[model samples]
Target: GGVALVIDGKALGHVLEQGMHHAIVRLGSVCSSVVCCRSTPVQKQQVVKTMKEALPIRTLAIGDGANDVAMIQEAHVGFGVMGNEGMQAVMSSDFVIGQFRFLKRALLLHGRWNYLRTGL
Candidate 1:
């Protein structure tokens, strides 16, 4: 499935709504869901809850700002992107990435390697 990108704000709602419609038409029956603009942490949590109710599955949240802390906490795995110093997201996440390129290695290579070693 394709991913949906949303900006955090009420104004982005219209954009997300349009994107959702376009995604529905473009992906047709393969599109399982559509989520519109979310303006608050409460809304983000509600969305996650709704998705879980619809289909119980693990979810991962990756973010790089203080605004993302709530959603990150709601996800099964939360990754904080530390592109620069003093980013609050790094403090709140389960894992922190110092560089953008290292994110792939952290998730795929390091995480998997550790999992294999521990069998957890």
Candidate 2:
């Protein structure tokens, strides 16, 4: 069983500031994924930082805009989608993809192969 929690920027602001473990535990028990919407660049970075520090798992951030540069850089692995947004995100990302649909193959295939090879 799994759930996806949709949190807006404002609702997550407080959690981003402090006590992320509590929020992670409470949320993790019920949800397998989280979708944060209407977040600022700072908020996006903080979320990535908070999760990276709080969990023992690698973090991945994906974006296609300049506003996503900070978040992309902050994550353990960042994927930038090439689009009209510009090259800021592409430069900051660990990897760049021409289209969003390719994310599945990139992650499920190449990403998995890399993970196994690296033993991470």
Per TM-score, the best of the predicted structures is 2
lDDT by residue (1-120, candidate 2, tens digit) is 788878888877777667564685467446666667888899888777777776787778899999999999999999999999999999899999999999999989997899899995
Residue lDDT tens for model 1, 8-62: 5574455345545343234322334334344666556545544544455666666
> Which numbered prediction scores highest in lDDT against the true structure?
2
RMSD of each: 5.6, 2.6
lDDT of each: 0.63, 0.83
List pairs with backbone clashes in candidate 1: none
What TM-score do all the candidates reach, one by one? 0.61, 0.82
Model 1 RMSD in angstroms: 5.6
Q: Count the backbone clashes (under 3 Å) in each candidate.
A: 0, 0
Residue runs of model 1 more than 4 Å from their true location after superposition: 1-39
